[model samples]
Target: MNHAMATPTGNAAAKITRLPFLPLASSAVAKPRNSSRANFYKEVLESARDKFTRAISFQSKDKDISLAKALHYVAAEDEAYLAYNREIDAFALQNERSDTSSPHDAQGFEAVENMPMDGKNMNEWLVEIDAIAKEVEAELVSRDIGCHLAEVLEAVNKVLFETRGFKRSHVVVDSKCLYLHSVLSSGSASAILLSVIYIEVCRRLNLTIVGSRVGDEFLIWPPTGNPEELFKVTSGRSLFGIVNGKCVDDPRSKASDINSSSLLGLEIATNRDIIGIALANLIRFYWKRASKTNYGLMLTSPLRSAHRSEEKFSKDNCSEMPLLRPQELRLAIMASERLLILQPHSWALRRDYGMMLYYNREYEAAVQELSICMAFAPEEESEVLEPFVEKLHLMRLEKSWKSSLGQKGRLTVT
Candidate 1:
């Protein structure tokens, strides 16, 4: 824990100290006479702490407390985004007040806003990764290891996998394997996360690491003119072993099995795509768990006409399943919301979000979101979503009527 304190200014002369592992704590203090700002800051701090607590206290099947720590990473990424925007706004304000501006200031702001918000939390993990990279660089310098791709790859592999014991986790669905922080702490991660770590470390070493998606898997390597030759040199493997669609097994018998055609067939994944993949995994895991519960299916079921008696909505038939905790469903919704932030125009994602909102019994929000989805969705998708939006509107009205009736009954009794 770094014991750094910020020098207070003007009316707000109270010193602010850093909290261990949480920079948001420093924002607890606010300018004097600004109650709204103070309240807002307080809310931010409390929300972050609550999220962190929930993440740490999450119960897992194997009694492992650390398994659900990815929740914290997700929350941290959101906080990082908010912090980034705050900084940009502050900088712009400062420039405006100073009456000094650069030719590209507005363009820079627009570019920043347009950039994908993937891996905003990478900076939090980079400090440790940068240290590890520095160690590898120092070792290479000492051993006279030049910047040859193979030599650098070998050194990085030894340091990360051998010395540090970082390896690919067999259980890809586990939350522990999906997040960078948990991966670093547990010494095991899924293929994508391991690739992310590798990419980050190589970035620190001034080596470029590019990723490509082959089927469902993300594989990364150094950029080279002769990719096949480089694959042969690197033995057609990465830190996670053979880079195949099914990352777990090595079915290739020889180096020649990795041909130029297969390598060229790989579709390059942008940073946004990688982060989307990770969130998509989380959505799958949470949704799968939610679906096992009795009421879970109803949340996503399409609203059918009253003429279709068999598929009609009925509250009597739906019962809460204790096994499917609300937190799990909420986590799935949170992941979906974050993914939507990255790809705001994705009507399919918006539809999913609206469905999840419906499941959560937020009928008004569900109707609003699904209506937006209808506007951008194709004709077929829009048709399918129409009933859902209408049903949600009806549900909202019914809820309001019930509340009003309850109030009227109370007045009559009084």
Candidate 2:
């Protein structure tokens, strides 16, 4: 078995450890200005700044400074995000634990218990989701439902779309749609998130449903197993497969089979992928916001329909545009960094991070990271990006030469 291609199919899959659901934790985030919390925040900020400055000036030579400090910041931010999720756990536990009033409130805890806390709390909103699944299951079971696959799928769809009112949103630039809490709260989510809801519900009902790409978007496919068998062997839920890098070496495979293994043999998006997607959504939010303000970074094709285009994302009626402001770019970079925290092995993530570094104008750092990306990227992707990466390398080389010349007091400006 190729080490990279080896998969934990069947029993071997059970041994893979995951981010555990720890006891509900607390956040040590700094408080508001003029308070004790403010002091802590200021101290941390100062420490990070000091580290950053020393790293830049090569004063301490203790830490590589730029990469090290950025990673440290990412680590701390990752912890804070987990803490935020813990808060959600506590909230869900508190709200849905004691309440036997509604089936959702009653079973919500079970759903929360089922999902491991992995720095995100869409699971916190999942208790009600569990309740809905049980309710749907109970109703279907009561109707003496047969093992007809299409009928079962229709039932699942009706319960979710009509009864629960779960629907897809048109907003590509809204980060709120990515959060399960926000989705349940708003009764709307993006295609991916809504598909998540569908998959979760079906899985709870012992359906072997999976989310697969349909066109440029994703949808939950119906189960392939026997309904009775699904009901019988229900105890633990399977972990979603991780997309550590390119989804597939060959894009051709993706067009033919949506369930094809991703790099690292990830058959589906893991919790890390979902979190990465959410963070990417945040980056898009800022990008979209900046687009409206007529300033942004990279641009994409126009929306397929007006219904989905929350921001016009247009200026000269062309589908593409550039609109990154410094602050917005920073926020996007931080989100991408957090995604890297969640998925360290992701080559695609490293590529995005390197591009973000370029957007931030740290040419040398960008080239360094992108150089690593060259080793991991698909052959075709590498070919397409080769010229751009070379240009960045050249820019960094010239920059280093100028600095060295200035240090020698031999720099001449023409």
Off by over 4 Å in 1: 1-42, 45-124, 233-249, 252-258, 294-300, 303-310, 314-323, 408-414
Candidate 2, which segments miss by more than 4 Å at Cα? 1-123, 141-151, 225-285, 290-328, 338-349, 362-364, 377-414
State, as a TM-score between 0 and 1, how close model 2 is to the true structure. Answer: 0.48
Model 1 steric clash pairs: none
Superposition error at 362 for model 2 (Å): 4.4
Would you estimate the TM-scores of all the predictions? 0.65, 0.48
Model 1, range 1-414, lDDT digits (tens) per residue?
011111123332222112121213323223323233333433443454454444333243212322223334464544433453454455556556887553232222121112222343334454668788987887689779678767787788778887899887645666677767677777888777787777778877888777875545567767677766554524545432432223534454232344565666667776666667778877877777776655446534554442244676443222331335554666677678667755767878888877776776666667666666665677766666665465557667778788899887864443
lDDT of 2 by residue, 1-414 (tens): 222123233443333223221111111232332333233333443343333233334233422222222323323343334443344445555556785332122113222222223333433444667777887777678779785655556567667777777666655655556555556666777766666666667667767555444344553444333323322212231112111111222364342233322312324554334444556776676555644566433421221221133543222221232444655555566566555555555667777777766655567667655555555567665554455555456666677877898889964699
Judged by whole-model lDDT over C-alpha atoms, candidate 2 comes out at 0.48
Top model by lDDT, which number? 1
Global lDDT of each model?
0.57, 0.48
* Candidate number achieving the greatest TM-score relative to the actual structure: 1
